[model samples]
Target: MNAPTVPVLQVHQLTKSVQLEDEVLHILESVELTINPSESVAIVGPSGSGKSTLLSLLAGLDQPSSGSIELMGKPFHDLSEDGRAAARAGTVGFVFQNFQLLPALTALENVMLPLELQGARDAEAKARHFMDEVGLGHRLNHQPGRLSGGEQQRVAIARAFATQPALLFADEPTGNLDSANSQKVEDLLFKLNAEFGTTLVLVTHDRELAKRCQRTLVLDNGTLVEAAHASTGA
Candidate 1:
């Protein structure tokens, strides 16, 4: 008999709000979701719909004002900031729109940083392998400033996948790139996911990107409005 599947990510009654002056601005309200392992999911919504906020909370990068998030089976709300950081180590990877590469670090070094932090002795080899996978082996020595937007993003993708995390989160990963580069990045994301079986959760406004996911969640007015065709700009 097959065992019941345990969700890789779980969110129940997730809500987030902040105090602005004398007013309380609610950013998210009763958001609930569950994601199984190795599933590719997209989070999409209009501006100010809390897509990024939801991503942050799910990734344990930030805590929600009133909610609990279970990521890879650990309750984030129950952990301290340092505890959450410890939990995320080696298990979660992030790709960002800005590339987030260190200006002074070469592509190789930037990709190696996370592995080194995790005390992997083969950091160089792994970084090299992922760089090659992303078609940037020749650009290993190039600094972020010396690389084009697409190349830098490719490096970021390499960095994210080098750790072989169980879960990957990306926030508008191709937003800063041109259409050509965007397509390249989009391709790389699904390729890596297929190759690694990494559960992917992305927050993107790109309809094409959303369509590529196995499923999509539409966030509107701080709530999830389930849709059958999320890529249709629902």
Candidate 2:
């Protein structure tokens, strides 16, 4: 008998809501999902559909109000805040729609941030290499404000990859870029995935981007429904 494959991420009956003065706002309800190692999946939905919220839960950045979440085969709810942060540092990388680069840091410095957090030696060298891979070698010294939007995003991508995380979460990664720049960033993302065999969970409204993944999951009012299986040829 063969051993069973471990899921990289798992959520069971995940629910999140907030109590308001008037009524309760249910952001997510009874959401169940899983991602296996080396799989790429896209979560597609309109604004206010809880796509970002779901991503947060899966990444262990935010806790689900009710339900269990296991990341990298460990029960997430059982971990302390510091434990969760350490787990994320070891297992997850996140790219946000807003390109959350520090205004004070240069592209090189931004890429080095993750490695520094982990106390990795030779952080500067590794940061530069990743930045070069993202075609930002020339902009290494430029701060976020000095670089263009796409350039800033590439820096973010480089930073996300610097730690060589097992799973990568990207929320509307190309949402803020122009068409050409979007293509560049998209290509870089997929290239990294192919090279590293990284598990990907992406949230986006772009149909074209969603189709590129092996699976597409749709969220309607915080409930997940399978949209389509993996298909070749975009």
Q: Estimate each model's TM-score.
A: 0.95, 0.94
RMSD values, in order shown: 2.3, 1.7
> 112, model 1: CA deviation in Å?
0.6
Q: Which portions of model 2 show Cα errors greater than 4 Å?
A: 1-3
TM-score, predicted candidate 1 vs. hidden true structure: 0.95
lDDT of each structure?
A: 0.90, 0.88
Instruction: Please list the residue runs of candidate 1 whose C-alpha ends up more than 4 Å from where it truly belongs after superposition.
Output: 230-234
lDDT of 1 at 22: 97
Tens digit of lDDT per residue, candidate 1, span 1-234? Answer: 998877889999999999999999999999889999988899999998999989989888778888778877778766899999999999899999899999989999999999999999999999999999999999999999999999999999999999999999999998999999998999999999988999999999987889888898999999987667643221
lDDT, residue 219, candidate 2: 92
